[model samples]
Target: MAAELSILVVAGGRGSRAGQGLPKQYRKLAGKSVLARTLEAMHAAAPAARLTVVIHPDDQALYAETVSELAASARAALSAPALGGALRQESVRNGLEAIGREGEPEIVLVHDAARPFADPGLVARAIEAARAHGAAVPGAPLNDTVKEVDANGFVVATPDRARLRAVQTPQAFRFSLILAAHRAAAAGGREYTDDAMIAEAAGCAVHVFDGDPQNFKLTTPQDFARAMEQLKAPSLADLPDVRMGQGYDVHAFAAGDKVWLGGVAIPHSHALAGHSDADVLMHAVTDAVLGAIAEGDIGAHFPPSDPQWKGAASEIFLVHACRLVRERGGMIAHIDATVVCEAPKIGPHREAIRASLARIMGIDVGRVAIKATTTEKLGFTGRGEGIAALAIATVRLPEG
Candidate 1:
């Protein structure tokens, strides 16, 4: 059987240096909080691992809000937050001890909450190294010459850059070994900067593995700005294919009391007629997403001629379209959708529809835009004969 794994996220710092009047982990990066993104990344890397977060006592409310921002699956993978101690070492120790009580895991990864880019490959390597060597840390090679300076700033000794590595976390270790090391350090009234250092002090031979340069930590205001810039506009080399697709769908009135739009049912005099649940908005959004990737439309994928698709929920179609985008190494950047209807007032359910689409697409609600309008009694929608929806989906795909 594979070894059981757990992850400890240390996020106790007040982030006085980051200068956002809030903890750096709680600060918004892109559309989500840094801590939320970190947790999501960790969950994505190790889907089976149990995760716990160490947070400052004063940040309980802030932490709750951050947790609410995560996707349901990611949030479900998390254990309750552990109250952090004054120092990073104490915070990690608290996390480890808390998880230990829930029954120990074979391997534990101690990660910094400020670092949100530890991809799955890096995490897999860390796990393999820990299992083989008992203790390991991810390390990137130093790119500059190193010097040991005296008190007056004169160079005392020059060190070979090739022999040194800049270490990062998600540092992995055997659960029992690290727990004992932390306990011994606490008993001796000693504090180490990181878990790897404590493991070394405990006479464990720590191994270093390759680390990604992009897995950098957020420490200063400049670092935060750089991270935001990177997210806003990742290099073309990473995502060179940006495409926008437009989709329009319409459904005429049928004999029913409700109509489904964007996965929400609204009470109406008549329902929309279609092979599926007749969610015009969701259909347009799905086709828009597929079109952005140059994939065929809804009919081409889930043909109305297929009996299995009859009466199926439109949410299923949108979910499949989003999955296809992900499988192609692409992401849905944003979705802008407009609903044209005369009978059912859409203003009351605008936010609900956006939330529903966001949940189905597995993206933030901020990336989805839902708008409603009518044709002034001019077209089929204006004639109350049918409802129509138009959508534009923006997506980013890797270069060929």
Candidate 2:
């Protein structure tokens, strides 16, 4: 039989570094306490798993107050708090021992209360890894170079960046393996930072799984300020509403001295054939913007079937789509488009197209990307018969 899973949340730290009227874990983030968010993630990952939340003896009242804000199911999922010791290692040992008394669960996940961004997928991966290898921790690859320094703060060595990883908690372990490891450490009067290290000291194999960049620990005062900014940052799922829309348009070559793309007229032997200026790029962008707001495509707004649009600039269509976004209480986050053509060489015009589109859409140039490619002499674009464009837009809006 596979071992059942359980959780041990260590919330014993004072979080003094985070500067507290309250512990950082108990502080509000996005209108909810950090610990509450952490618990919600844990419960969402494995509702059946037994939960043992460890805290400082003096923090019982604070813990109760925090637990009160959780939903009924979440409150019911928590076991009685385990009183922690002076050291973080001791606190985890206390949690492990408590689980042992209640009937040992086969797998246990030990996590910090400060990292509220723990996702259910990570939790499930940790549990699976631990069950296979007996001990595992989630970690992400470091983007910056790391160094090993002495007490004097002199850098002794710069480690290879490729092999280095910054580890995170929700360290998982097989029940008997971790319990025995912690028991051995306590018996020897030894201590370590995390359960993975303790398991490593006891000659147990430890493994690493991918971790999320957003699952950062809330420690320093600066981190709290950054968290506030992150709450406003782009997250498709966490935001009130985010939608993506795609657009594609094609136009055949016609007799003209210049061709228009993204509202910019470039000297060319042939122009795109369309009721409007035949700016495929602008038309694609317009459709994408319209689709994101769910107001239909460019044809719905300005049909080629309507003679008034004949010889009109495509930029006006794009502007109308953008206006609809504003009217719907939304903003465009990004627009990416690809142009397919063998003629009129898109290399020199790429930046111009992006800039022109940005100006027309009333957004920063950084938010737009215009790329060009050919069909490798395989399609109509390769034969120089027409130009085609594909685009996608990302938009953010208020929830209904």
Candidate 3:
């Protein structure tokens, strides 16, 4: 369906509480500005909707820097930053007026850009509700104890929490109703906390739908720190070190098989069968190399169907991975591999395997360490049903 809605993102607040010199919306979160993530959420919610960001005049440089760092697809969707007014309401009115000059939308969504974790589903539901019922906003039912207090620290009475709801945006409304409401509020000097409150005071019924708790606004320095922590933890789990990558592979042993454990062909009574030679060590190492560059898994790059790879020696695959890392401006730091099996005492051949892999990868033997272990007659590998190999590769990229 053709979306006839424009998103007016109110991001111009000075954010005095955050105290980072930059507005809270422009603060870094997960290596990118919070506004960028908010914009991403808005676009994901409504891909076709026109997005207008209201930014403080002083924040133009900060906004530009943040948008420039975003992916091409995200940057392309952004319109130039429009200067906001003295208040958030005025800022939103400025954004609405600009969108009005472009083309009057069927509906408009006014949102706070500090809430980066807004759910796309909730936004969609809010828009649909507004389109059908005239105006709508997402809200979570208040579940905390409510107390009413007077000035001078006097407790009056406890209100019912069940009767209250904590509101969030994108607060949706018909274009005509919201524009007129904002104009009236602006003319009457009525500055409300949220757009829905303004609409409610203007005799407009604002429907409320359930919203997510994760959509809480990032308002404090601590909140920014938490977001940064979340981003780094996931990336760290995926990468142990700049000079190390780890991998593991396993295959079952069947009758009439030529065992290819590593890149080296080991003459055996049976052979491992799979999409490829099923060289556990090579597959594990290939994955480690790819992981270092954040490139993806081996299966994503090389599928089993390619005619050139049928029953191909796994060494060729390992060489290709090494070349890929080098091409991407990275060097192998070190790699440690281990083989597991009940039979085939590989302790004597560890040095040979290490030297062979080091030669193939064009690295020193010391940088490549290989070891073997037995499963102690426990499971599949322990029962001599198959062999498994684990590899860890350390790679380094030049620091910019």
Candidate 4:
């Protein structure tokens, strides 16, 4: 029963101390935000865990923008952020209260959004330790000698270094007990720097487990710089796996007033006939993207036999193909598509088609190329009986 877990990521602080224009947790790190990586680590460690985030109320737009970089699964696992208070402790309390409204969790992991290097293994260790004990925190042994200082800035007591532990978050606890502790603290008009103290005040025994030195929190601009240096992606062009794929599609014309092409509806004397809207250009590009990822074709993803996809806007297919590429850690370097038709005059709408494709694919306009061609009385397109499209996609994948 205690195995069911919930994790709360605290990202409410403005991070003004970090000397960044954005919150430290929202700043880019290793091609992703610190909070994104933090959420990813927690999800990887406990796939079954429910996740919640706490944020400053004014940061809704910023939060939305930052979370877009997360993987789809991680984003889906997250609950809407609980509006935070002025202090870190209050913010975490708000998150806890919000998570309570959902359901009671057996185990709860309270994590700092600024620490992105806490990997799944470390999280697992903390979870195990917490389940064994009433509460537990991940901490590393002190490498520096410690001394207690007074208000005069003079050493009052020199403590043994062996007993000192620098605790880090993803502090784990029994949900009920920690919740009770936080509520009690709030009622008493008290606040602590971290959740462990609340547990300690509530007479719950908290244990410490081995922690990674790399799981350091970003506190200032210098700290962020150091983290960037540690986590930045190095030169990887040489190790990349580049791939190219091609697709071709043809659709016969039927009487209609307009036709959909590359997500844009253009006035035409006839519309393409197919199970879907038969945006010939979109079908070709989608197939090309899927092929580049070695993931079959558009037909596999959007089967014509399924009633759900009947008369579907074909842009859905292209979006799916693009998402597949992203899920595989691949990106579209370029997508070049050619339209073949003897009528409808594609020359008048070439740029519009390209822009539409770029929007659907979530790529830049420069990366999407659309051109028009004619069979010149050589085939069906030459006779105005149908339209054909050919697409070539270039993809870049990370090497193993």
lDDT of 1: 0.89
Which prediction has the highest lDDT against the true structure? 1
Candidate lDDT (C-alpha), each: 0.89, 0.84, 0.76, 0.83
Q: Model 2 over residues 1-400: C-alpha lDDT tens digits?
A: 2228889999999999998588888999889888888898788656678778999999999899889988888888788889999999999999888888888888999999998867554676687678668899999999998999999999999999888778998999999999899989888898787888899989998999777676789999888877777566444453468888999999999998888988778889987888978999888888998888888998888788987567776766786687677556677899999989888888898888887787667578999998899999988988889999999999888798
TM-score computed on alpha carbons, candidate 4: 0.58
**Candidate 1's TM-score:** 0.61
Tens digits of per-residue lDDT, candidate 3, 1-400, equal 3249888889899888877577788777757788988988787656668888999988888888878876676667666668899988889888888878777889998889888876555676677678776888888988789788999778899888887888888889998888888899988987898888778878999888666665677778887776665444222234334755667778877666356665666766666667777887778877777777677766776687775456655665676677666555566878887888876667666777777677566577898878888877888988778888888888876554
* Highest TM-score scorer: 1
Clashes of 2: 0
Between candidates 1 and 4, name the one with more favorable lDDT.
1
How many collisions between residues are there in candidate 3? 7
lDDT of 3: 0.76
Residue 53 accuracy (lDDT) in model 3: 91
Instruction: Give the candidates in order of TM-score, highest first.
Output: 1, 2, 4, 3
Task: Evaluate residue 216 in candidate 2 and report its C-alpha lDDT on the 0 to 100 scale.
Answer: 88
Of the two candidates 2 and 4, the one with more favorable lDDT, higher being better, is 2
